[model samples]
Each structure stands twice: as structure tokens, then as C-alpha cells.
Target: MHKFGVWAPKAQKMSLCWREQVLAMNGPNHRGWWTLEVQEATCGDRYAFLLDDDSTPYPDPRSLRQPEGVHGLSEIYSHGGFEWHDQLWRGSPKTGAIIYELHIGTFSTEGTFDGAIPHLKYLADLGITHVEVMPVAAWAGKQGWGYDSVSLFATHEHYGGPDGFKRFVDACHATGLSVILDVVYNHFGPVGNYTGKFGPYLNENRKTPWGDAVNLDQEGSDEVRRFFVDNAIMWLKDYHCDGLRFDAVHAFLDLSAVHFMEQLSTEVERLGATVGKEFYLIAESDLNDPRVVRPREANGYGMDAQWSDDFHHALIAVLYSPKEGESGYYSDFGTIADLHKSLKHAYVYDGQYSGHRKRRHGRPTDGLSAHHFIHFDQNHDQVGNRGWGERFEHLVGTDAAKLSIGIVLLAPYTPMLFMGEEWASSTPFLYFADHEDEEMRRLVAEGRKNEFAAFGFGGDVPNPEHEKTFLDSKLKWDEQEEGNHGDFLAWTKALIKLRRSHVCFNDGDTHHLHVFSDERARTLVMEREEARVVVNFGDQPFAFALLEGEQLELASRAEVSVREGYLDVPPMTLAVLLSTSEQFENRQVEARARA
Candidate 1:
């Protein structure tokens, strides 16, 4: 016999339909819970729930596997059936972690969770500690970025379904890597969403770009909050995921005094404590507020980290000029100073900005640690939203590209690499989705074209409706073995190794930045606790007056040299230096004399 339960607080009456039998359930405790037991209800059995007098069967909001897709009936799944081999695996701490963000569909040609297994070793070899997957929840169609998820609980069937994901997670853990899943709780997809048929899962009072906001603070919202919180716990507890990266917390329209984010963070922390494991929550926010990752004890939301869009925007704008004819958001950023500010401090527009939103925006992140921000040169949105979806390789030359990598990896923040970025994969991560609705498909295609016009791209944007767009985004695995691609991969690996070996590199403390020149011979020197990093962004050789006893420990071949009390750094190169042995010995002798 199997006991099934679901949260349906809005339903006056709920009945489980399985194998031609309907089992009635009772719940009025404001929990919106319904439960039923049947002998024939087993794994793989298709089921749905009948709510009130609704004739149509609604898929369970917490469906484990929708093998027939999001629009079809939910299939029962036993979480314990699979043998997990990660019994002794404890996740890596967030400090000094190298995160690689990937979309399973485009990570490999097979476009399945199983297909990505072979590349696990590649990521491991690249020194990635955590694999941050884009949203994998079941969405409307077969192909998408997984952001438009209709079934928050179910894994996408095309990506090898539930079992496939379990295997993937297990494989990752076996290789000493942790998995961080990106989850969306703000809004359902534009298609195949049936949560409303069963209850008030959306708030009409609040609206977002997607639609009505999730009912996190309205009447009957208690259960809704519980539903999402439970889902997050399920991923960590049941699926064995190490962390969750919440998508767009800025879109959460809750007005509750406690706030939905605070509630979720508190619960996740409790669950992590109970399990005796380290579970983290990362948020994707555009607010640029440090409070989101601040500790709850200080009356903050208590998220572990958030995406640093300011860092990316500042880096991209100065490095890659706005496309030929026009400029929109990228126009606001242009100087080496902007890049320097973002690298030293997480935000470029802290309490001062007008050109973008026409209003002063963003709060200062002055006291925050660098680990509170996740920095990336290119992510899914930046690449996909482009007119032709060009990667960094297409936008800049190899030298500039290496400089971008150096800035990101050596910065005092956690760094994330988009899939195929290590080797500078040529394929563009275009905006592609499998929308069965003609109107939605047309709107997406048209919107994409219009959006690129501001950037000055002349041609028509690639149609997201075409399967070829999705196919074109897949990584070319063979590139890893050839040409500049191989060189890039090697350089990235060396950088990661260097970062891991250096204690100062892992320190997220912001260093005081000193910039020598702005235009032709610019040089930035950052002094951390015991070491210093000097970077020359210009082509001509530059000199910096270092501390008397400082010596070069690591320097890029092209742009760095040390002699006497001056360090000569070449154009667009970075160098790491530490105090000389004689200096340390002299300091020790002085301390002994003082004692």
C-alpha cells in the first residue's frame, strides 16, 4: 500500500484519481493538505487530483515525475528505490569554491542528464567545486532555459526525468563535487500551469513581468509559502543537493512583515542544521542591496550569496564596446575605474545612478564579504538576450578574453563560469524555447528582435521557434582538444590551480585599489593582507613602486617583471607578489629583540 499526500488548502474537497479508483481526503487545518492510501498506488502509476466540483483532473503540485510532460498526468515515484552511493559525502564549504553554471540540454549533444555524466570529470579537472545547474524543473515544452517552469516539483522529462537527475547528483558527489540547483518560485510558466485550478496559488493584487505574483503574503498564502519551502527542503533532504540558487528574488512581491525570503531562509537553515550538513541559498537579484545576503540576526534576509550583475556589466561595457550603431544599458559603463570599483567592491552604482533607471538606485555593500557575491563574466541571460547570442570569444580578442578571466578569478568574490566558457566555446547560447502556443512563440521571437535593435544589431534576431537555434547552442566537445580552445582551457585550469594554492586568493576581503593611469598606461595595484596583485590594463609597459622587500611569486608571462623596488607589468596582464624571505626573517628578529 502507498500513502500519498498533497497540499491543497484552497480546495473545499479533494479526491485522488488513480487506477480507476477515487480516494477522498479530508483537510481543514489551513495546511491545505490531503492524503490517501491505496494498495494499487505504486511507482509509475499515473495519478491526478479532483478538486471541488472541477471536472478536469489537476496534476499534483508536488508531482515527482511527469513522464508524459507537464500537461500530462503525474507519475508516482519512490524516492528510495535508487541506490545512492554518497553516504559519506559532505559538501564543500562555500569559501574558495569555483562554481560552473551549466544547462544540461546544451552541455552535451545528447541533451539529457545521463549525457552530462562524461563531462563530470572534465569539470572536476577544471577545479570546479560546485556545479550550479540552471532551472531543471518541468516547463511547458521540450526545450527551454528552464526558467518558465510550470511544474516546480517535477524534473523535466526530456532531461532523462527523475532517475536521471538522481544519477547525475550521485555521480557528482562521488567525484567530490556538490550540486546547486537553480529554482524558480516567483511565477509559473505561460503554458500548462494548472495550480490555480486547485487553489489560490497566485495573487491578483500583485503583478510582475511574468504575470500575477505567487501568493506569498495573501489570504491562504500560509500553505503556499509552506509549499515552496517544502520543495526547497525536498531538494536538499531527498535529492541530496548541496544548495539552491533562487531565481530573481527581486520579483517576489510579498509584503509580509517577515518576508517570504526570510521565512524560506530560516527554514532552510533549520533543515540544514537538522541534517548536520552545510546547505546554502544563493539569490539572483538585481536590487544590488547587500541586506539580502546579510545575517538574519542583524535583521537581514540571510541569503548566502547573490549574482553580481554590476560586476559583469562594468567588465563587459569597458572591455567590449557597445555594438556598432547604438547603446542602451551598456552605455552607462565605459571606464577602467568602473571595472576597478566593481572588482574591489561588489557594486558600481551604490546609492548613485541616474542614466539607467532615471533614479538613484542600489544600497552600499560596504561591510559585506566578497563571498556574499557571485561574479561571472558571462552568464545565460547576457549571452542569450543578445541579437546573435555571441559568446565572449566572438565579442573580444583572445588577450582581452584572458584579462576578463583573470579579473573574475582573482577578484575577492566567488566566480562562476558559464558552460563552454572555459575553452571559449564558439556556439552562441541563443534564446530558444519550445512553446506550443503560436501566439507566445511569435511574441518571444518579435520581442527578441526589438530588444536587439537598441544594441545596434541590424539583422533579424534568430527565431527562438526554430529547433536549429537550440541545436546551435550545444557545446562542441571536440574543441577542447584543438587550437586556441585548448590553450584557453589550459590557461583556465592553471588559474584555478593558482587560486586554490594561494591563501590570499581565497580571501574575499576587499583590498584598497590604486590606479596609476586611466587611458594609455593604466595599472591597478590591490593590497590584501600579506600579498599584492598588480594589473596593467593598457598595452604599454607600466611601473609600480612596490614595498621595498616585496618579490614576485607569480606573474603572467607576457606582462610582468620585478627589479629593485619597481615592478614592470605589461599591457593587460596581472601579477601576484608576496614579501621576500629576508623581509620576514628581519621582522622575526625584530620581534625577538622586542620580547
Candidate 2:
């Protein structure tokens, strides 16, 4: 016999309908929890619960796996059935990790978890240690970015559902790669959400961009908080994921003492201890608060890391300068000083005035490791939300594009690469959704075009609701084998190799960053620690003054130099230099360690 239980506090009565049998249930303590025993209901049995006076049955809110999609019946799944081979996998920590973020639907033509497996070897070859997939929870449509997730516990059916996810993760572990899943807990998708109809899952007392916020701190919220917290633990325990990237945490407008994030973190850590595995949580917050990543011992939320938008904005703004058109958030950060502070310190507006927010924002992250921040030049949000969904190469030239990639991989922080960014793919990552409602489709299309107009890119805004727009966003994998795309792939591969081979580029070090710009000389020099990166960001050849004892470790093969103390950096090229003494000493240390 199988025992089933569900929490439906508001319902007067509940019944479990299992394979042509209706089992009546009642709670002993008025908690509204109903339980039933079934002889034939083992794993893979279809089931649903009927509330008092409701004709339509509802899927279990805590369903383990929904192979039939969210709108269909829930399935009884045995989490222990799958064989795991990662017994010795201790997991890689956030420190010194290179994260590559991807969306399953558009990442490959198959648009399923199984389709993503073949690309794992490619990511591993690029020296990526972790793969951060965007939210895969079952949403309203057949195609989406996964942010519009309605079912927190179920994987999207179109992406081959739960079993397919298991295969994908298994492949990742086999290749020694950690998986980080992006999760959205602040709000539900706008469609196919039936939680509010059953109980008070939403709080009208607070509001967010997606309408009412989750009922985290409001009345009848005990079970509600448990509902979300249990979902978080499910991903870590049942799925064996290494970490979670919480999306838009600022939307969680909770005034409670404990806060939802702290409660979730505590539960995740407890689950990690039980399984003898390491689990982490990373937050995406626009508030720029240090408290987000601060440890619980210091009276902070204790999240592992966070996406640093300040670093991205500073880097992109400086690289794609003439930011008058369509740069949006990149417009306010077009300066060498912005890039300097972001590199040395994590935040650019630490207690300083932010022109974007028009207020004093952020706090100093003193004594914090660079591992606490994840840096990137391009991400899903940066490209998709734009008018044309252009990638970095679309905005900047080849040399500058390569320069941005070099800086991100070499910077002293956890780095992230968006899908298709490695080869400078031409496909735009646009905001597309398969909303069946015509009214919603029109609203999304018009809203997107109007939003871009405010940023001065209105004339050529593509209609987001068009089928062609969505089709245009899918990557053409054939491009990876030919022309500039092939060259970019080779360049990125070399950079990743250099990063993995050098300890100086690893996380957790603060070196003074100095950027020397000479407009007439057409050269820029960036010095960090014992190494210096010289770039010719102009049209003419420029000579760099190497320190007396400096030795050229690596330079763009296009560069030419006659002497040790002097080198000519060709226009639009990059070079790396190091002291001969330091290089030889580190080489010997590496050799001894290997021996």
C-alpha cells in the first residue's frame, strides 16, 4: 500500500482519485491535510485530488515529477529509483568556477534536455566547470525562456520532462561538470496558475511587476512558506543539483523578521548535510545590497553568490562606448573609471550616487573574495530584452569583442558565458513567448517596442509576437564550422586554456587595476598584480613601455615587437606581459606539484 498526503488548509474535504478509485480522507487536527492508502498506486500511477464542491481535480502542489505536464495529472515518482554514479563527486565550490549559462529551448534544435548532452563535451573542452541552466520548471507555454514558470516542482514537459533532465544531469556528472539550476520563487507565470484558486498563495497586500507577490509574510502563510521552501529542497535533494540561481529576488517584498531567503537557505543547508553534498544558492538582485551574499554568522542572508550587474554594465558600457542608442543600462557606465572600480572592488556605486537609479545606492564589500560575485559581459537578460536581441559582436567590432572576452575570463571573479557567446554567434537571443491569448500577445509586442523607443532604438524594433522573430533567435550550429565564427571559437578556446593553466587569474585576489589611456598614442595599458595587459584600441600601431625586467608571456599573434623593453601592439590587438623571475618561479612550483 502507498500512503499519500496533501495540505489543503482551506478545503473542508478532500479526496484522492487514483486509477478509477476515490478514497475519502479527513484530517485529525483541522490542518486540512488529507491522507489515503492505495494498494495499486505505486510509482508512475496517475493521481489527482478533488476539493470540496469542486468538479475539476487538481494536481498535487507538491508533486515530485509531472511527466504529463502541469495541466495533466500528476505521477507518483520514486526519487530513489534512478542510479547515480557520482558517489565520489565532492562538487566544485563557487570559488574559482567558470559558469556557462544556457537556455535549453533555444540552445539546440532539439529543445530538450537530451539535446543539451552532446554539447557538454564542448563546454568541458572550453574549460567550463559549471553549467547554469535557466529555469526549467513547467511553465504555461510550449516555448519560453523558463522565467514564466507556473509549476515549481515539475520540469517542463516539452523539454522531455523529468527523466530527460536526469539523463542530462547524469551526462554532466560523467564529464565532471557541476549543474546550477536557475529558479524563480518571487512570482508565478501569468497563465495556467491554479494555486490561488485553491488557497491564498498570492498576497494582494504586496505588489510586484508580475502582479501580487507570493504570500510569504501574510495571513495563512505558514504552509505557503513551507510550500516554496520544500520546493527548493526538492531540487537540491531529489535532483542532485549543485546550486540554484534565484531569479529577481528583489521582487520578494517581504517585511517579516526571518525573511523567506534566510528560511530557504537554512533548509537547503540542512538538506545538503543530510545527503553529504554541497549545495549553494545565488541571487539576482538589483538592490546592490551586500547583505544578500553575506554569511548567516554575520547576521546576513548567507547566499553563496550573486549576479553582479554593476560589473557587466561597467564593462559593456566602456567597450561599446558611443552609448547613445539602444544600450539602455549600459548608457550610464561608459567610462574607464567605472571599469577600474568594478574590477578592484565588486560594485561601482558603493555608497555612491547612481545616475541610473537617481539615488545613493550599494554598500562596500570590504574583505570579501571576488568569488562572491559572478561577472559577465553578455547574459540572457542583456541580449533578450533588447529591441533586436543583439549579442556583443553585433554592437562592437572583432578586436573589441575579443578584448571583452579576455577581460571577463581573466578577471578575478567567477565568470559566466551566455550560450553562443563563445563563437560570437549571429543569432539574437530575443524575448519570445508562446502565449495562446491574443490580447496578451498584442500587449507583449507593443510593450516591448515602446520600451525600446525610450532608449532611442524604436525605428527598427522587431515585433516580438511575430513567429519569424522567434525563429530568427534559434542558433545556427553550422556557423561554428566556418568563417569568423570558427576563428572566434578558436580564440575563446585558447583564452579558456590560459585561464585554467594560470593560478594568477584565479578568484580571491585584489590587485590594483590601473588603466593608462593615450588618445594620441592610440594605446591602453591595464596592470594587475605582476602582469600587465596592453591593448591597442585605436587605428594606428602603438608601442608599449615594458618594465625593465618584464618578459612577454603571451601576445596577440598579430602583434610585433623588436626589443624586450619595448613592443609594438598592432591596432586592435591585446598582449600579456609578466616578470621573468615570477614566471620561472611559478613554473617550477607547478612542476614540483605535478611531480
Candidate 3:
């Protein structure tokens, strides 16, 4: 015997259509839940709900398995059936973390969870402590980046389904890497969505840029909110995931006193305690609200961390200078001072008036620790959403790209690297989706083309539906050992090791860091503890010493030396130095002897 339940508030009647056995559902509970226990149904059985006796049936909103795709009947999956080897896997809190983000479909040749497992050791060897995967939730398309998720609970069938995910996670844990699953609860995918038919899953009154906003604050919103909160708990507890990265949390609209994010965080914490695991939640937010990561006791949402897109923007503007014309949002960035501000204060526009936004943006995060911010130079959205999906390596060239990696890894905040970024893969991470319907495909393709019109960079955007787009995005994994790619990979590995080796990389005391930059000289000086990282963003060779005479430690391009009280940094180059007078004197003496 098995139990099946669904929330169908609008349905006058609900029936469970088992394999050739249709059983009428019982009364709707006070919460609008209809449940049925079937003696004949067991694991592996396929079933769906007949809403209001309509001929068309809808899959379970919280389906564990969707073997027949998003529109087909849901399968009865036994969650704990797989044999697990990671019994002693007590996940990490991931402090001062090194995070690597990968899209399962394009990470390797196989494009499945199982395919990704073989490379876990490779990532672990790279000194990455955590792997933040893009959303795995099943969608209508055969392949995608996994942002548009319809079935939030089920792993995409194309990625080897639920069991395969467990195996992949187990493998990762075995390889000393924690797993952070990216989840989308802000909105469901556009096509093959039947949750709207089940109940008021969407708020028609509130609209987001994507579509109808999720109903988190309206009438009968409790159940709808529970559906997503419970989904978070499912991933953390049942799947043994270490953490979750919430996608586009700003898109969630809630006028209610208690926000849905707070409710979800409360439930997830409770589950994490019960399961005895170190679970965390990170958010991709544009709201710039410190309350998102502040403690719940302090009247905040209590997310563990949030992505710092502003950091990426500021760094890109500095690294890829000589801009043609400012794009939509990039117009707001591109200043050496902006990068310096981001390094010292976590955000450049911390409640300051913006010329681009035409209003004050972002709240001060001075109270929070540096670990609350996840800093990265490259991510999926920054690259794939572009017209041609060119990586930073292509945009700024190799040397600048290498310098950017060093800055991100050594920064006080947690650092993340996009897949293949370390290796400098030749392929691009283009926007692609496999939609079966031509009309829907055309609509999506057209929407993507116009998305960047405001940004002058959106020239001749490719058809996202074209087969070549997805094929071109796949990473050339073998390039890890090839030519310049190998050199870049080695450089990244060294940066990660250096970060782990130094106490200066500790993200706890962000208040102590200092950033000084020369806009005209196009040079930056980052000071933390006894170490200083100097960067020259301009095309001309730059030479200067902030503290009269400093000792060169590690140079990105070559062995650095202080000539005439200035460390000569070549064009698009960088160098690490010792700020202590004693260490500087010792290194100076050694350099003179060698010369």
C-alpha cells in the first residue's frame, strides 16, 4: 500500500489515475489537500491526478520522478532505495570556501550526473572545497542551463534522474567536496506547467519579469508557500545536499509580514538539525538588502550567503576597460574606484545615489562578515546570457584573465569559478535550450535576442534554439592538459592553494582590508594584514611602491623586482608583496645578492 496526495484547491473532484486503475479521491482536507491510499500501487508505478474529472491529467506538483518528461505521468520513486556509501558524510559549514560552479549538461562529454562524478576528484585536486551546480530540476526541454524549472523536486531525467544524483553526490562527498544545489523557487518554467491547474500556485496580481509571480503573500498562500519550502527541505534532508543556492530571490514578491524566504529558512534549519548536517542557503539577489543574510534573531531572513553581482560588474569594468559605449547595466560600472570600493566595503553602491538607477541603491552590509558575500569574476549569467557567450578569456585576453582569477581567489569574500574557467576552455557557454515546439522555440529565441537591446553589446544574438548553440557550450574537458589552457589551470590551482595557505585570506575580518587605486595610472593596491596585491589594469607598464619599499613575493607574469623604489608591473600584470619592513629588508637583501 502507498499514499498519494496533492493540493488542488480549484478542483471540484480529484481522481488518481493509476496504471489502468482509476480511483476517485476522498474529500478535500481543510488545507485543500486530497490524499488516497492505494493497496495495488507500489514503487515504480506511474500515476497522475485527473483534476475535476478532466480528460487531461496533471503530474504531481512534488514529483520525485518524471521518467516520461515534464508533461507525462509521474513515477512512484522510493527516495531511500539507493544504496549509500557516505554514511559518515557530515557536510562542511564551508567557511572561507573555494566554490566551483558547473552546468551538468556542459561540464563533461556525457552531460549527466554520473558523467560529472568522474571529475569530482579533478575539482577536489584543484583545491575547490565546494561544487555549486546549476539547477537540476526537470524542465520541458531535453537540455538547458536548468534555470527554468517546472518540477522542483525531481532531478532532470536527462541527467540520469534521482538515483543518479544520489550517486553523484556520494561520489563528491567521497572526494572531499561539498555539494551546493542551485534551486529556482521564484517562478516555474513557461511551458508544460500544470501546477497552475492544480491550485493557485501563481499570483496573477503580482508579475515578475519572468512571468506571473509565485503566490507567497495572497489568500490561500500558506499551502503554496509550503509547497516550495518543503521542496527546499526535501533537497537538504532526503537528498543529503550540503547547501542550496536560491535563484533570483528578488523576483519573489511578498507583502505579508512574514516573508516566504524566512519561512523556508526556518523549516530548512529545523530539518538540518534533525538530520544532523551542516546545511546552508545562498541567494542570488539584486535587492542589495543586508537583511537577507543577517541573523533571524536580528529581524532578517537568515540566508547563509548571497551572490555579489556588483563585485563582478566592478571588476569586469576595471579589467576590460576601454569600453566602446556603456551598456544597460554595465554603464553603471567601469571605474577603478568601483573595484576598490567593492574590495573594501563588499558593495560599491551601498545606499548611494546611482547615475544608472537614478536612485539610491543597496543597504550597508557593514555589520555582516565577509563570508556573507560570494565573489566571482565569472558566472553562468555573465557569460551565457551574452550574444555569443564569450568567456572573460576572450573578452580581455589571457593575461588579464589570469590576473582577474588571482584577485578573486585572494579576496576576503568566498570565491567561485565557472566551469572550464580555470582551464581557459576554447568553447563558449552560449545560451541554449532544446524546445520541441517550433513556435515556443521561436518565441524564446526572439525574447533572448531583444533582452540585451538596452546593452549595446547585444549585437547579432544567435538563435538559442539552434543545435550548434548547445553543442558549442560543452566544455572541452581534455583542455585541462593542453597548452595555454594547462598554464591557466596551473595558475588557478596555485591561487587556490595560496588562499588556503595564508591567514590573510580569512574572510572573518573584512573591516581590516584596505584598497587604494589610481584612476589615471590604472593601478590598484589591495592591502590585508601583512600582504599587498598590486595590479596594473592599463595597457602600459606601471611601476610604483605604495609603502616606499616593499618586497615582491609572487608575480603573475614574471619575477618582480623593486627598481628605484618602484615594483615594475608589466601591462595587464599583477604581483603579491610583503608590506612588513623587516620582511621587505630581508627580501631586498636577498634580491641584491642574487643580482
Report the number of the highest-lDDT candidate.
Answer: 3
In model 3, the worst 10-residue window by lDDT is 321-330
lDDT of 1: 0.84
lDDT string, candidate 2, 53-171, tens digits: 78788887777666766767888877788888777776776677999999998888887999889989988878899999999998876788888888888889889887788888888
Displacement of residue 281 (Cα, Å) in model 1 is 1.4
Better of 2 and 3 by TM-score: 3
lDDT for each residue of candidate 1 in 405-461, tens digit (9 for 90 to 100): 877887779999999888888889998999888999998888778778866878887
CA lDDT of every candidate: 0.84, 0.81, 0.86
Report per-prediction Cα RMSD to one decimal. Answer: 3.0, 4.2, 3.7
- List clashing residue pairs in candidate 3: none
Sort order, lDDT high to low: 3, 1, 2
Better of 1 and 2 by lDDT: 1
RMSD of 1: 3.0
Q: Per-residue lDDT for 474 in model 3? A: 92
Residue 569 shift from truth in candidate 2, angstroms:
2.9
Better of 1 and 2 by TM-score: 1
Error of 2 at 595 (Å): 38
Model 3 residue 183 distance off true place after TM-score fit, in angstroms: 0.5
Model 3 spans with C-alpha error above 4 angstroms:
321-326, 546-550, 579-595
